[model samples]
Target: MLSSVAAPSALLPGASPVPVHEASAERDRQWWRSSVIYQIYPRSFRDLHGDGIGDLPGITAEIPALAELDIDAIWLSPFYKSPQKDAGYDVADYCSVDPIFGTLEDFDALVATAKKHGIRVIVDLVPNHCSDQHALFQAALAAPENSPARDMFIFRDGTGENGENPPNNWQSHFGGPAWTRITNPDGTPGQWYLHLFDSTQPDFNWDNPAVHQEFERILRFWLDRGVGGFRVDVAHALIKKSGLPDWGGRADGASIEGFPGHEAPMFGQAGIHDIYRSWRKILEDYDGDRVLCAEATIDPLDRLTDWVRSDEMHQAFNFAYLHHPWDAGDLRSTIEASLKAFDKVGAPTTWVLSNHDVVRHVSRFGLTGGHARSGDGLGPEDNQPDHVLGQARARAASLLMLGLPGGVYLYQGEELGLPDHTALDHGHRQDPTFHRTNGERLGRDGCRVPLPWTADAPSFGFSSTGKAWLPQPEEWRGLARNLQALEPASTLSLYRTALRLRRELSLGHGSLAWWPEYDAEGVVAFLNNGVLVVMNMGTSSVELPAGELLVSSAPEAGRDGFLAPDTAVWLRLA
Candidate 1:
């Protein structure tokens, strides 16, 4: 439960409050710098039409709920017209809405509704690839070899006996070979095309001027429709080395453990920055503080900062922070390094715990070991997580993340303490990764299950037809939002209180300073906006600093002036 404490005095002895700079019109326009953005997996957020799939109308209906959480924006995963080959990431038409989600009018309505609630919309933009069914790709298939149409994508002749093998040793991110052989319009085996992900999603030839012009037009179309910004998908892989060079890595395309730079021929090419510079010009030409957030997965986080340069991207997702273990020292080092790196480029660091491509943080923290690798879904065949321990740690982590001095991204249903459906039936899995790997890896279906809204309602009130695109676990009934809303100590309630106080105190815009006096093994303490935020990751309780208790992740956080293990508390020192 939220602790009841005395109001903070205007001033206190030996306390230095983090200064909140005066907000000018320019500062107000740059809201993304210190904003909290909510990511909505459109396929699972809500099924308003009872088709067992979430849609634009469902998101519009939930604007009030998002407003209550005090988030600044909503980042919708791909809803573009597609064949659903890659679950909407393989966009067929960048400007049209998919029938499975809704029509263009429905999307317009969502934008209008979000604007009315003072929330901006950020759409997912997949520029690296497109669905094979796209008109240009179809034209490329029908055109003769060496035709201008074929030049829009990477199509090269194979180099082997009878030209039967892949052009190079490059591998797909999903699984299997990256190149797929295609049949010529005549009855003969022809050149192969490159696809970094699934075969249905073919990579575009960024070297072509037409490809650049097409993406610019797509960007303006969405910006004209009043979107606040775009979350660039696979931002680092847009360009490849001039020669399709062979790689000496695993067939699965996993990065090496300690590689210092972009050794892979397919990713982090210097030419990618030129594309973004051109895009930045287009965004600056717009009216609002339109942003561009990169989803680049480059390693050695210092290299990742390149995407967030002032003239490139507004923010880049800090994967190092997301994948860090639950140890106090590890988290502290990651936070400090991320702050320092992004500070050099004058861009706010973006923090995230869970997303559509990874296991939920609650389940990840519940494991006995350190952080779980992305796409390593938990299941009945594997060791199960301790629900009680996972929930406690997740709550504590939330407080720590919220108190940091940068932007934050909240995955949908995380506020309700939802854990991944780890025990989902294998037969029901739909992720391409699972099929491509032949069930060797569990993929991300566990974290993409439909959210539970009502405890007893059919399909947890997600769909009127009592069906969901992905099945929800029966255990989720206990974590339903409707039931948790009435409980003061619930995770949902904790998030509400934390976000409210964060905005009231302008905590997001404030600075962070490590409080070294309370820093010990398995303990992390920091000061922000006159609040001493402390987390005890150790087994024993620690003495709390003298201050009024503002809020806590656990009910017994400040009991007897001691902060309990696995608990986080925010104390107002002034």
Candidate 2:
């Protein structure tokens, strides 16, 4: 039932993450694997208290609209109690609300609300570390010699070898050393611990038994609270090279960032799998599939399969599509490769066109005109899709991703065809990393902007207060929710139609039949069941055999609905 093809865009001669989707699992497994997932970055979603920051309450309010989109689940970014460092990725407490997001009662209500609407809630679990200000870490550091808490974290003595010799050359993902030199108010000799990301966040020593118990409790805490699953943050980094030695500085001008000046090679270390095995056992205790999607993309195709093998994770993301260049050859080969790999591993795949981590697809591909910020190498003309000739070709990408053999991940606002706004002054930017780097990193704060739900309403009805968190979608009020929803030809209307078709027909879980030449430079074709799906990438009309048209990204018949440029059409082949 699924289309299988060779791997796409290989750099190394060897194949990666072979596809291993099990044919015997319920179609729903693959459905979710292929289901459409909508990601919600809470801090920028909505403000229930008008506090200039988004909250769970705001996301709660928007659930109805998402449900209408027929989305399978909402991948909510961390809403757990945190100091807000790295925007909720740093947990201060595993079981409580951060007060700013509201109380435990509120989260419970949100979980209840989502389930009542048949929606699943997936929270961000940053088990790789905890906030330095966390009570346990404080207690451990306060009474290391005598505190049982001391064993909870990774603490050690160094030979006072001066700053030149670090315990290891571990680099922080944000900018420096994975370890920090900290002395109590007493100015004691410093101890070392791993922190793969920001210094404020420290990596948990998963090799320790205490680390296992704490994480298990954290996992069960959310599951007991009605949360369906978690998206493991840097999940692959949990294990290290073990009893590590110094990697020395690269000396090539690339000192590990954020960290003092080194790189952490703990990634994909052998010990990590044991940690995953332990975590998997804990997850299995839950009543249902407790999704454990990893933030792994180093070797996506191979990594995906490794993480989601029968004994590992239930699903992994398909970032290849996101990273691939937008052309027929790449798209065709990638999809075919993905299908083949899934088949090999008996695992499922999820397609995320956009998320809070990277540039928006529309922006990345320069699919939307009037915005030249994305680095897709397009001229001013390329941004502007030729309306009559390019609409179908453009819409084809969505159809292909949604109709593929696995899950689909959709970002909020994409349902409304919102375009990126490159209107930020240095002073207006809020991303800590972007601000720290002076614009070198895109920091994902732009796509994290506020969503435009109701046009005629105040602040697009996303918040009831003044100066909402993150900027509101500029000029969206005119093409606002109510207005676009009222007009059938509007982009919102198209989204509605597409979602409805997807949900009503159980589109995502089905097998994909990508055209034999999925890599065709001008068109991306596939057979979904009995229907033929075509997306024309060229500037001229492309013809399909005479058949009944199911849906068209553009209006009018293409000779027989010849299809327009940058648009798509689906038909039932005679």
Candidate 3:
């Protein structure tokens, strides 16, 4: 059961119940529409085996702590059997747990423990590709051209003299040609295979019925294990345009982002919807409000909304909103656009600030220039972030995001006010992007550093042996969970208070209305179920609305009936 926390009524002495609808059976079935799901990168979450690598048992042990946050669900990143080529994103076995993470029994314990605390488990499902070490991929390598095994993946004969060049111009996302030539039984260059990511992760030929059947079986296997749903990885890239067309005569190894349209040959294909519609049926068969959340990065809010249509996925990450600069106008416009777009498909918009694959929001907001792009790495050689300013903005952003009327996805360490290990040494990096780019791109290893639990313990209490896969920064000592647990003004305390009030007010399911009367030049003011939520982004303080102060991102900044810049507040209208 979730740990007891002070109720909003207790926090605000004269506050009345917010006029939001109560949860019922029907609402329960549609719980995901307004759910707060936390993404846990398993390898960095906790290490119970003293091996420096976190596992399932480590997560199970922290169930009580998670339950206290009042999150509706926990989304576990890929823990499937893999070669660790892409930090478990490259899966060799979807149905079993990786030996490093623990056994199947450990996973079962995690599911049961999470369920007992009213938290649902959402597994990461990688369907666009599989690890080269997968049984089917190995068989495909040995099988003759046009053989059934080879047909399971995209394979084609090279085009140039002596078949030395790749069949297409697609480039690997990690920084190289997307195709890798395979050797036949006689040691001849048999054919080339496609890998949108690392060469070790070969793209699956979704055109094959066998591929569809295999994933469907994999889905059922986990659904039977009591998982609430799956977070579909690269949800939009599963189906590529037929004929393997060239990307508009671009350079052979050019970046995919340089391509022209959202309907590029490699992504946002219409056929991908058909695939989700089938998975939706599988989820519908289950008793609970099972869901499919998409990790699609398609451009234009409308195109991304297509993944979350009523008959398809339940939610899709709003990447456009995530990448937007921290300006009131930009944020407001994005929020309005996202709400309108997802509303058209009868699906809820999902908001996110930081995730395992991107630079943490704290550092991004603190950058001297514009926000950092996805897959960007920060280090000692780069301009350092303003730690104090970054944390304040991050806290304000969280309050603003939680006040919106939709589902929210919180990254693992955001609540603890964690920042990326921007000064990590190059030699200590492990992301494939770092190696593939030949040290050009620093990659996402900085944000994936192990969590800090104890301020004084070695490895910050992440592992008993004091060993961590990715080194934790020394500055994290003050931000450790133990020290923050004792500080009432800490980010963790604010998160707990906000989460409790959000639940009490039913804010996630509430309606949103722009309170333009209170909006200033750089301030965003809105009313969520009669609660006035105000965020000041300008350089000076703004007069607060007539309301009883309930919670503020920077409480000290709310003095004199004025909200300071880089601060946010939730209030009950007087």
Candidate 4:
């Protein structure tokens, strides 16, 4: 429709120049193989221009911080154009940066700056759905009958007398029906489209080859813009049931807390494999070992292994261990399952005990004495411990994550000894999960609030603007990064030392075997290479049948492999 108009310079109208150097073949070759990715929720990071929201420049300015963390890369959450209905996950445009975050130029500068720091940028790609307001969706909505664009969405006919029944009884993850009826200009009604999430976010029909082409074009668009890789979101839900059957209504009569929402029979459909294969092709060409990490679920751990079969994804997160009890038997089976899954895919494994979504491990398992605290009915003993259990659980989880065969992914505050607690009043909750009005609860939000860089600064240096997007947890003050950096026995110090050791041994190079838990009550014990890993689930100290302590979650390390209350021990085997 228009001719190419050239700008005076490649730079934007007004911007400072950042050095750009093409990454060497070697640098990109094994880029994601052993890298540790730090996820950045743009809304919770620094607000550069003080618009009360974090932007590209703010992240660009913090590249030095990431470089110093001894991490593999930075995985940024959605920054694409969107209406912010479901945050940026409901992408409006794959190629453009949301104006709220910054301009296209800012994104380019951020990418260049990151590459210069020996870090690759892995973006959160949300292609399964798009904002209802997106241009493509709008075009499809306004199309003449039987148009190609119309096929992009799941359109259904109107029901007379009765209000239009949704294509099925499938529920949206955020709340109601997976389908929404559209009204025509005249008082008449038009067809409906399927949305797996918030209604404003409509699910794309993977059956449409055009949809595949559209996403492929989007992939190249960002790769050309210099993004190193992608962390595919809701990846397994790309395809849906053609029959569109009714969901056996909610169990508790609540839409959100029930299974019918996230794991609709439509999820992980067989047809979605072609979608991944096509994406893999574009990724192979542009990425020098660039990876596709599917946020595969932990509950039904086996469902997405096909995606990680090298043909689909480089790795998928095993969410099983993150929710495990501190028992030896549970840990053994969890590790066994992962070991088997890893061997099956012929791809490496990734481990973590905490992330933005789950309750922090130290607070949940280690501190609650193995039970996550009940948030609703609490009038009893506060029996809180004197010292933070996070210190011990942090070390324990780290020993498990880092000592595993694959790469270790530690969330931001985990290394800082941050404690987890639900300090939010009922009205202040912002998590997207909708729960049953009864005893049920939605996902945790306070765990992912913000990272504090300094102790003396206000809001722990998280902001200079209005209140933070999520309330900073009570554990924020003393655990600031700048403070812990100086303490020898601090969590930050331990993390740095462990990471250096991991890099030295090429921890990424070896495979792992989980030894039996060495206790009467199934306490987890694993043999990492030759090191003995024993975690004590009991309140008393447990002895280790091994060498000197390389690291101990408990203060009292005994020759008998004695671990303190809710603690873990790592020792070299003779």
Q: Give one digit per residue, the lDDT tens place, for model 2 in 437-491.
A: 4555445566677777677666787777755666665566765677777886666
Instruction: Pick out the ten consecutive residues of candidate 4 with the lowest summed lDDT.
Output: 1-10
Of 1 and 4, the candidate ranking higher by lDDT: 1
All candidates: TM-score: 0.95, 0.85, 0.94, 0.85
List lDDT for all candidates, in order. 0.86, 0.66, 0.85, 0.67
Q: How far in Å is the alpha carbon of 379 misplaced in model 1?
A: 2.0
| Clash totals in order | 0, 54, 0, 10
In model 2, the Cα lDDT at residue 511 comes to 56
**Model 2, global lDDT:** 0.66
Tens digit per residue, CA lDDT, model 1, 362-474: 99888875434444687677778888898999999998888877799999999998999988999999888888878877888999999999999999988888889889999
Each candidate's root-mean-square deviation in Å?
3.0, 6.9, 4.7, 12.8
What ranking of all candidate models by lDDT puts the best one first? Answer: 1, 3, 4, 2
333: Cα error in model 2, Å: 1.3
Writing each residue's lDDT as its tens digit, candidate 3 over 1-574 gives 1221122222134433332222233443578978999999999999999999999999999999989899999999999999998999999999999999999999999999999999999999999999999999999988888999999999999998888999988888788788999888898778999999999999999999999999999999999999999999988888888998877523222225656456468887788889999999999999888999998877678888888888999999998888778789888888888887887777788889999988899998888665344347788888889999999999999988888778999999899999999999998999998998887778889999999999999899999899899999999999999898888889999898888888888788777777664444698877787777889988887776455777888757554567888999887766
Clashes of 3: 0
Over 4 Å off, model 3: 1-29, 248-259, 370-375, 518-520
For model 1, state the Cα shift of residue 216 in Å.
0.5
